[model samples]
Target: MGDDASLTARKAQLRKECLAARDGVGPLRRAMAGTRLYARLMGLRGRTIAGYLPIGSEANPTHAMRVLARDNRICVPVVTARGAPLRFREWWPDCPLEKGAFGVPVPTEGGWRVPDVLILPMVGFDAGGGRLGYGGGYYDRTLAGMGDALAVGFALEAQRVEAIPQERTDITLPYIITDAGVFGADGTV
Candidate 1:
């Protein structure tokens, strides 16, 4: 197999393992972890924040979104097309939501904005800030274009792996928040 093909196969295998681990988390543990994740994000400073609604076994940031929305603008990602970068739309707790691409909930209205901070969901990550997403490349493309937005990933501590297969198009996240603690891109926690 070629380099790209090999990397793709490796990623698929890792993704499966990581997702299973996340899915195996009990409901009570997941809830506690979500609370901790929200507490960690409270210290960050950002006027406009983008957060994702939990899908399946992903960690939910709804608690943080509620707190941030009280004093800051909150937005959620909307997948415009199959291969297009995500569009950020203003969202609040009670905003009308409709299922978007991949069955993820997105805001119904169309007031878009650029977020100063973006909280992303991840399947797995490494100490070096390499993130394993759902292989959609949406976050990578969005981060590449966002310039200076603080990209923070949300995941459970069990999702951490020794390393992730990297591609030229991949974008490294500066910070990843987990139930245990926050990990930095430079391998600091």
Candidate 2:
């Protein structure tokens, strides 16, 4: 197999393992973890932050977005097309949402906004902030477009791996927030 094939297989294995671990978490525990993540995220300073709605067993950040929206602008990514960077639109707790690509909820009506911070969902992450995502490359493309935005990953503690296979196009997150605590790109809490 070539490098691309090997990387694809590795990502597939990690995604399955991490997703199972996340799904095993009970509802109460998941809620508690969300609270912890929210607290840690509140420390970051950004006038406009982009977040995502929870899908499946993904860790939810809606709580934090709600609180942040009170004093700051909040936005969510809209999957406009395949093989393209996502477009972000202003979003609030009660903003109307419609199903977008991949059934992800996006704001029904809002102007385009660039965020100073972006909270991305992760399947797995390593000590060096290498992230294993769903392999769509959306976040990576989006980050590449926004050179100044802070890239943060929100995940459960169980999703941490020793290392992740990375390609040249991959973007590493500088910060990761979990139920346990906030971790730096080097994996130090």
Candidate achieving the largest lDDT: 1
Encode model 1's per-residue lDDT on 1-189: one tens digit a residue. Answer: 598888999999999999999888777766766777677667755588999988998988888898878878899998998777888999988889989889999989858989989999999999989999999999999998998888998888888899999999999998988877788999898
What lDDT does model 2 reach? Answer: 0.87
What is the C-alpha local distance difference test score of each model? 0.88, 0.87
Structure candidate 1, residue pairs in collision: none
Q: Which stretches of candidate 2 lie over 4 Å from their true place?
A: 43-46
Give me the displacement of residue 13 in model 2, in angstroms: 1.0
lDDT for residue 20 in candidate 2, whole number 0-100: 90
Ten-residue region with minimum lDDT total, candidate 1: 37-46
Error of 2 at 90 (Å): 0.9
| Candidate 2, 62-148: lDDT as tens digits | 988998887788999999889999999999989999999998999998899999889999888887788999989999999999988
Residue 102, model 1: lDDT of: 92
